[model samples]
Target: MRRTKPYFYRLLQLSIPAAMLVLAACSTTPEQTGLEPAQADEPETGLVTIVKPFPENSFHDLLVAEFAIRRQQYDLALQLYMKQAKQTGDLGVIATAARLSQFVNNEAAALQSTAHWLTLKPDAAEAHFIRATALARSRRPLEALQHMEAVIGSDQESNFATLAASALAQSEMDQQAFETAIRDLLERHPDNLNLKTGVALTLQYRNQEEEALRLIREVLTADPSNMHALLIETRVLQQLGRINEAIDRLRFAVDEYPYHKRLRLNLAQLLTRSDIFQAKAQYTVLHNQHPEDDAIRLALALVNREIGDYESAKELLRDLLARSDQRDNAHYFLGRIAEQEEAWDAAMDHYRQVSGGDQLIAALTRLAVLRSEQDGLPQARADLAAARLRFPDQDIQIYLIESDLLFEHRLYKEGFALLSGALKRHPDNTNVLYARSLFSERQKNVALMEQDLRQILSNDPDNATALNALGYSLAILTDRLNEAQTLVSKALKLRPDDPAIQDSYGWIAFRLGDLEVAENYLSRAFSQSKDHEIAAHLGEVLWRLGRREQAISVWQQGLNNKPSSTIIEETLQRLQVNLPDSE
Candidate 1:
């Protein structure tokens, strides 16, 4: 709750143990992940045995070292790793050892050890990959990219090479080289859905959602057995308005990979939004299959929450949280369930024990939203200011939240200013830019708002949020009906069922003099129970359609739902609508 200078400093303490994670994260997650035993226990080769030729048995010792790491015995793991690395003078061993050292919070030691490994291994492909992995985890992307180049240059066929390439593509933004390598690899392994999915994922990071979808579909057509590809495709399809198509793909994946927990979870998520009964059935099946899977329990809790069983959801998360001995993540989910109960104070305390940058940010954002709702704008600003102070250089969505709060308070100018300010700091932040365009239209600043929306689309052509905002604005405010249609159609292609996006098309309908169609979309948006903007737009359309009484009723109800809005005031005055105000 209290803020200090750069709370990301806690990561430094975690970094000591994360050196090990650097090494672990970098290790070759080969096609053959996990030990299914080398064919019916054919002698625990190379591992399990102390090296007879202790001085020169480098590979054997390497396995031994990695084995100790897998066992989670850090101190013993470190000692064995050091011995093997020293005996062989192999730079790969040295680099891996440095990674293990990092796992124990010995960052200086890791840097020292890896530095020596690079010096000796000069040409070792695995060493470069390992070094890059450590550097990237340490938040040094530029340095990580440089080392990734070394890994790619040495050899592109190693198991380690695939991981290095994938990480570089996503984290280092090395798209040209990354796309080239991945596409080439996919050409031969066309049946390998995982490889193709990995390539498609790179497209996502580069802001190429259309291309990403294209790649995903290509893989799905090539081999429907690719469960991971199916799951990702499901998400894209759901976002793009092909909800049934996405759900069908997930259903197929669930059938194909029955034991795959991730596939089951993905299916559950899709069903939760599209079909509550199916979601409940899937959750029930998964819960029965993996009787102890805490995640399944959590997923079921979410289904309950969505279906108006809040008490059940709360009880489930609470039970799951209590039994989760080592599961910190479940605690964070429990906090969300607590939030549904309106137990603000409990949610705050629950979020405290959870770790990681992402979970911390979510907790902070939620806590700030609650404070903003409860105490007022100044207190909310202070909360966000504290978050900014805690994560000075991090991608904190402080501006986005502040703008949302300000928009609610009818401070449209200030709301837009926060987003513009955020764009100054993070020039390519799509969410902030999209929000600015939406709010700009509200303030009637047509030129500047359109410019901002166009900028977002220019940078991210498939930016659904910008497309919806721009189209919706033009429909409601300007006379660019054709342009509005084009933009809204593009947005529909990306996120068809999203209530806000549906609202955009409806607004366009109203502009085209199709009050019936406009009413349909606006009604759908209101049914989703999201924002006040939907209500405001629906009332305007209703007023135009001669549903004067209904229009008056809707506007007054919206104002009651959220009082103090210029839109409400203007609508009421123009209509001479009389209504009672809520206390």
Candidate 2:
């Protein structure tokens, strides 16, 4: 009367005996046979046919489910498994359903399956853990915490701190809520070192450094050999900007735990940042101990490169390139080494192998330079165009590099045209504007130069390079002495130790007839940089002050440094001093 047609239809669909379905629905425990408890009292009715009908549709569904699993259709498999779990009341099927649901990221179905599993096996730690994880991800922290407590109580394999930390890490709660929850747990489990560590980690994540450090120290005090506590302490020290202290702590920890690779690796990395020699020593020992470890070998090679031991670095990189994992990086470093040695062919070969990562652009730029050196400007320009086509997002950098090549070769018109075209595409780009201004200076287009530099200043008032360039141009070529003085002074204040700015200040003083001031500034600039232009300026100042011998000595040194310095030659000829013969 209550509609047995749906039940008949389901039984037909499942192809199971009606009596077996009834037995499955009524079974209370996994060991229950086909007989329901109510039926067991009176049923010796000898219903062998009821027990014998094969679940053909369910068996076929299971086969289809396995096929789906083999094909990596986990979602469809999860649905079939969950249906089987509900029909059979089988613990194994329910657990599989829950696990498969989790695998497919079907949180709602996972929670449902895990809830049923827990109902069947109330004391199952794995079921509690799965439910807790699902609940936490679903943002039901309170329910998750209850199940987490049960998991901690039942699971003796992992400590309370570790489980709690794992839960906290996976929670979506905000910092304050996380801290509050963790603190509450800590109050309940005060002696749980793992839980304490978990709380400290949460605090650290929130940047509550002082509290985190205190808790980590407390844990270390209780268990001095605790590697986790020590690592946390080192991290806290680093966050406080006490890198040296962090290094010392790691060094001591490594000595105590001599075989602990992580501790030693941390010490080595910190040493690399502060003292390369010490880093190299540590890495050498590590490399000797772990000859099969490519990371250790790579670290040693990089340290060698940093210390200018290019031969050793090249040998290490060559050995590493024999393996496939670090081929690109090895090629990049090899290219750099070859470039240092001025072996253009060798450098290009290595750079061409470097096809990806952070060094790709740098390698390409170096390759272009080498091509220009070996072939010609036209080849370099063509290569740069190809590079731009290959890496369209890096158009700005390619344009800058090509323009720099032209400028260095004294092809002013070509450089200007390239920069003008780039500006048309990227009109507000500061680098292009700055480069164009420099090209205008070479062309002696003072108005264009001033306009470009002022445009830069309008956007970024503190651009020291533009300020110095503008000021120096006005001091040398125009009568805006006071304005030039102000601009150069501002630039000097912004970059107090810049030698170029010092030279500009000196040049301004010389133009204003302050010979002593000019000499002092020029001497400072020349002493700091040893630049040919600074040397020329100093010599001119000295010659004007009747110190002709000193001026000649300075000019000679400048000529030795830069054999073809036009500024030094012109100053010597203008002052009626004899120019030295070419060396």
Candidate 3:
């Protein structure tokens, strides 16, 4: 009744404790898990002692609970422990139940057990933290804050901050309530700098960025050297789209605290978007300071590669190769460098050495692509077949790559056949189905395209990609405007921030004769991505609204973004709109 399904999923996110194996060892004492058995009843006969079992906290219950735990039946174990806690009023049992409940995300159970725990040990910070977690999860943020305050009073401020972070990820209403509760607490602790920062954090989560910035400035005013406040101010400034201000703040912070690793790392990452040279300089300092840090070294290597300093990148990558954990990544990047310099043999050698890790598939794909160009398509296909046999887990991805290669060579029939075979081997695989659907569209097989997209929707009704695809296809290629509108509307609700889905929604609105709504949605989608198709749709809407000059300007901008966009060209042709050639 309390939606235990989501809690079960949350439980699965955690690694199962290795201690559960001890349940089967017979050496584990009942006190360890707090499901202690009742003492055996003995008859008064001096010669022979006959043992009797009691119903409450019986030995039988202990064995069953331990067996359940060994079998990974955590819910059963939790139930047994909860029952024992209630019957015996053992603090240990209550504590175990509380922790287990929280682990499994059973908010109600956690609250009840933590209440019992608090009753026995009123000063336990763990109990307050656990209770606060359950209360926050249950949308009782005010009550949760009280327990969080109690946790802080017990010098568990770190734990309270962790709870607050988790609370921020809750629903919008919950986030508002959490922010409001933090503000109320800040009122009580007016001079508490941590409280001020906490309010600023919650306000940022609630999207009150201006207010959050003001609060952080207040903290900075009180303590100019507050690193935490400085970090929060940078984040708030970034959220408010004032990246330069954020960069300046970080620059000042790094100047003030040159030894701060996080401050410099943040500065380096921020600079990567706007000023690559500045980013490289910051990363250089970070790398020099932390020579043993592989992540910093990798970042510096990437920065070097981006700046065309191939020799420096190669040196850093070679250094990373000494660490077994980073070997595959190192080989992958080295291969990329070789490819960039047109050293095909060296690139292939490096890629071949990437035997495992996250880069394995990428290396294999690149190796096959290069092989196809240098050797024949037959040899490349054979190599892909060998890769499938060697890495069966990557067979589907390998097949997709093969199809891409075939399509790139204009072998449409071969590519379609490859995807069809893949679909036979992996029926109802959404990725394969989606790929096949795109191919079907290219072949003008509208029915097949609809079928594949519909199959994806049937398997996963909330799949926004399939929804938008099917809806847009209907709007463009069929006379099903109403159906297209409905599908696209659902997708927009599911992924409101997705530019592709927004474009689909606008396209459907245009077909359904809602010009103003279409304009608004298309403008928003284009503003987010400047994507060619969205630009085409938006320009047409503007043209229809009798704003021909505005329409041409939008079209020109789209062309500047992507000169090879056939969609924009076709739209212009269809509308008989002639544009002057760019100077």
Candidate 4:
């Protein structure tokens, strides 16, 4: 079978003649005439022949048109190509004009040029494809489908199923009508599996998941090794939230076709989310089979990291970093590893090398956090400011990072001013408002704190952070014990496993004089986090209950962990309890 050129390639072929003509014109020389010395007495020929410039030849026009295309002047190129096509009656030229017109969004010109192209070469599949695409662009789906059908009918190897699928994918027709049209087409070719798959995909797009699944299952039953059917079935199951079922199905498929690399890869990737040990085993096998594949190596590294094999993960990531393609991802993951290990310097270096991708913002935030922990607020602020300048779109996150650092250092005025400026720029930003409220609490501006938290709650009534913060503040700083309990209880219900909210609930219970309840919640919170503030609160509750020895032990542990914790210092001072001096 003689293969036909793709639609775009046929259009590109039109430029060849124009390019040749340009070269020919450049190479052509005018006839050289011998000049004779004019006699002085000869009558002066004063007639200045103002030769009106010869109308540009077709070759010159073609040169200018090709140059226009190179300069992205598609409109001008389309005009020139259409004029040349009309003059030359070349089907390739007409197709080029049609495609360029479509490229520039000149629908009318595209239709006219496609008509000329069809007239020139009625059997050309590329011409039909161009006409179909133009019709699709003009929102004439039925006509476009007809032209696409003509294209497929003209070529035995035209991939009719893919063409139909692409047309249906791009169609703007009403869903039921689109499905009806596709079903009608499918009825004509009921035995064509590819067309059946296309219809199933269309059904899936229309949210008819049950029908889509039935068709895909039928396809898979007919040919159990059909990769496309298997992939679609997996996707449908995932959408239905039957992820474990999908994993099991993929695992079965992998067992059936152990040599199928894609099946193995899919099974491995799916396992990464649910069963890290199994995922690690699958990736290790793939790595052994394809040692040079960077993607497989990266996958192995990720699974290793998830399974707590940090040393193996570090080695694989370092090897990937040695290669250029996966360097950014390797650096990002290495930074994560270092951050987890508290290797602040190494983490900062790795994060600094991450220049792009989805990890860029996360890397910058980690850098700010590490700097704040190691060097203090000033350096962290400088690093975050530089990151902001580098990534202007992440202003909201940068503001939060700086404000968090300021708040952690007890620089209340600085934190408040920063959030105030950020709020002025983005007045209704929930995060900025939430952050400013925290600073307000620290500054003892209780009314402002309540106002800011209430504003956040108005926007998002179920904001657990605001609920817990307001509740904890009122419990410790005011006599609204019942209201505090209500808010903290709501927060705990929303986020039962969150240590911070648990601490808030514990503190509220202590204020309500429920020592046993306070002891239970605070003990759970401390067990989860061991945070110094939670420790301080727990020790205070224990001391109030006359468990003086236990309170001293908790405070000593907290002091060992965070020697300068303000809450611990204040609790010891107010309770008049002193740790025994160790010689």
Clashes of each: 8, 2, 0, 0
User: lDDT score, residue 455, model 3?
Assistant: 98
Among all windows of 10 consecutive residues in model 2, the one with the lowest summed lDDT is 1-10
TM match of model 1 to true structure:
0.49
Whole-model Cα lDDT per candidate?
0.64, 0.75, 0.78, 0.74
Candidate 2 residue-wise lDDT at 446:
85
Best by lDDT: 3
Better of 1 and 2 by lDDT: 2
Candidate 1: residue pairs that collide: 16-104, 16-105, 17-103, 17-105, 19-102, 19-103, 20-102, 20-103
Instruction: Supply the global lDDT for candidate 2.
Output: 0.75
C-alpha root-mean-square deviation, candidate 3: 10.7
lDDT by residue for model 1 over 261-350, one digit each (tens)? Answer: 788877887777778978988897888889787768777877787787878777777776666452455566667777877787777667
**What is the full ranking by TM-score, best candidate first?**
3, 4, 2, 1
Model 4 lDDT on a 0 to 1 scale: 0.74
Off by over 4 Å in 2: 1-253, 259-278, 288-296, 305-312, 319-326, 340-342, 523-528, 542-564, 576-583
Global Cα RMSD, each model: 11.3, 14.8, 10.7, 15.1
Tens digit of per-residue lDDT, candidate 3, span 1-583: 0000100232211111433332223222112443211111221111111122234333345456656755778798788878876875656557767767876778989999989888878887777877887886775666777777776544444233444566676787767777777877878878777667878887776688999999889989999998878988999999999999999999988998999999999999999999999999999999999999999999999999999999999999999998998999999999999999999989988998887899998998899988988888998899888888998998888888887788667676777788899888999888888877767766767899899989999999999888888888878888898998898889889989888888888878888889999999989998898877888999999999999898998999989899987889999999998998888
- Write down the lDDT that model 1 would get: 0.64
Of 2 and 3, the candidate ranking higher by lDDT: 3
Tens digits of per-residue lDDT for model 4, 170-253:
535554575687688778767656557767877766667788899888888888888877987887787778899889898888
